[model samples]
Target: MSRKIAWIAAGGLAATLTACPARTPSLPNTPAPIHVPPGCEKNQTGEYHHAENPAFLYFGEDDGGTLTLGVARAREGLEGPGDAGTTVNIVLQRTPDGFVGETRSTTFTPSGTACPVRFPTEATACDDKGLTLRSVAATSIDENCRPAPTGPNPQWKEQRLVRGAPDAGASDAG
Candidate 1:
């Protein structure tokens, strides 16, 4: 009887060991390398090209009531226009913060007139006529700025504009 009991205990122990799950080896912690897109490096002037995403233009009436336009990004390292092909007139102003203020106006050389403009941030408001502008409030500015690694020759893309409905289209008559 004692021998049978010992055999049963040994079988139970073996079964328990078999039921246990295998352990996986732990991997060492290592930081991943940062990815910088094409044509996003800094220029000779020490300004980096703005990244494409999270980057957007801002337009509104300035304090003097004149039309105001600017482009902003959430991250640093953006200096000049990366890929936005439109020729823009830019002005830099001093700000209390270390960063400088930038304003831009598109040169509609082809049409000889300023084309209606829109930015990612102002898309909703300008949806009506396909033309909208937004104010540069403290909150709006704060939400758009992001930190990024500075680089030279940062690449930029041109923003394409869609024309409004053609005037020639007429309503159908039954």
Candidate 2:
């Protein structure tokens, strides 16, 4: 009787283990879809070339529907050693008319002095052809990293970017 009871208990334990398999770890929630305005429905994910310069802008969607624009400029070593080029990161949130956000710029000088500045920006008239972006802020920090009073004119001038091919280095699978 004791042996039969032991066998029965072992069989029940095996059945329970088989019935409830180990649960896999849960994945993170997916990001919510970005709500774009009527005219802004066109795909804006690509690389843009400056109208007159060799600079390029890469526009892509980040997590949570935020748009990230990366600015890459053509710099030659002739500028001298330790002369790091300027880096600009622009984050834009979708709005009714277009995208509104700020532009953060950091210029690295040969002397290793870093001047970081920010400006309020707006992007409008985004289409399959190009995008119009303007900096609405009037104040900008100077090279000495002091808040300099800008004149009536805006600090960062407006720029028009013409659409170009998507960057080949970026993975499309994502």
Predictions in order: lDDT? 0.32, 0.65
Show model 1 residue runs off by greater than 4 Å: 28-31, 35-45, 48-174
Cα lDDT tens digits for candidate 1, 23-49: 889889865542222211111122122
Q: What value does the lDDT take at residue 16 in candidate 2?
A: 97
Candidate 1 at residue 84, lDDT? Answer: 44
Deviation in angstroms for 138 in model 2? 7.8
- The most accurate candidate by TM-score is 2
Q: TM-scores for all candidates?
A: 0.24, 0.55
Cα lDDT of model 2 by residue, 1-174, tens digit: 999999999999999999997999999997656455444556566677665453454555544345678876543344532224666778878755457788888754446678787788877667777777788545545557766566455657777777885444432221
Candidate 2 regions off by >4 Å? 1-38, 62-64, 75-85, 96-98, 108-112, 136-146, 149-156, 165-174
